[model samples]
Target: MAESTQQKLVCSRAKAKSDTGSSVTQSSSAPKRKASTALPLDMKVRCVSSIPVGPLVYTSRRMQGMIIEWDEFGSEQYIELAELQSMRNSSPAFFENNWILIDDEEVLHFLHADKYYGSAKSIDDLYGILKKHPNHIAQLVKTLPDHLKKTLSIVAYREYTAGRIDSIGVIKAVERATGLSILSN
Candidate 1:
């Protein structure tokens, strides 16, 4: 329903923050700090990237080398590592040498999979890294099935392609640097 008189100021800066006299709630219209966080205390979402890792994970079928959008809303997801490795071994396609993620809900990466596995770098920093490498980028762009390429994720690919996302290999290195877990998919 309605947010009442608060929350509206969050998107508007000047109106937020407490003045000398007012109820704490009415004056500070900004979002309160979250008491709990999934990231390290020092980390924050400096940028928001919705890069297409690949494919629509079908609720009915198992897919490989891809992150599935959970049926439930919001960002949490599952990766099927066994399916990824098996797919890599069997498919004619080549995937980025590693995978990147903030959490490990599944498996380990394969022989050549570049493990850019973390939620560490500021989104801008990571985005810069992805932009530098052509081959890695080619791999990412190609990973999308032709249909997805033609659809909305194509927009994701284009945005990243326009900006700088370091090579998948480079992001993989950062993953190792950040000490994040590597899960399957």
Candidate 2:
């Protein structure tokens, strides 16, 4: 929107008597008093390092995961506590005596399963593998076969539509099917 160049002036007093018995008036363009504001107003805050403690939420937006841990200086750290604990239990050698300090960007990448999930480049690549699996139906069928590939496809479609599936979900599905942790390849 374009702004207007003209401004209206506001006068505090209509007229004032001068010492010489002459009337004077002061015209001001700016307001004489400060504007009043509502107290205890609700506002939306965008915080990088702070998030409410709860279950991780999955979304299709660029921020695929919505779980952040904050530090003293308001610095953000993304840590999937549940996943980390499970991973520690499964692979004690990897977690034992480890400080658990990881970069926020890396945590986001790990959440999306984009950087370190097996030999695949992305979740889509894993989907492609499932698509070309030997057991996959080449043509539409009234009843899909009870195969791993078919189940994966169904789960993928359902989760994608529900805004739950992303690169991370895809890798996690693969891990669940094969009993492996996929935070890192």
* lDDT, candidate 1, 5-81, per-residue tens: 45565644444434424567566798864342233322221112233444323222244334444332123333344
Worst 10 residues of 1 by lDDT: 40-49
Candidate 2 Cα RMSD (Å): 20.9
Q: How many backbone clashes does candidate 2 have?
A: 2
**RMSD in Å for candidate 1, one decimal?**
19.8
Q: How many steric overlaps are in each model, in order? A: 17, 2
- lDDT tens per residue, model 2, 1-185: 12232221112122222422342233344465443333221322222211112222222122346433444222333333444434344443322221122333333243332222222222343345434433332322112222323334544555556666555545445445544343455
Residue 39 of model 2, lDDT score: 26
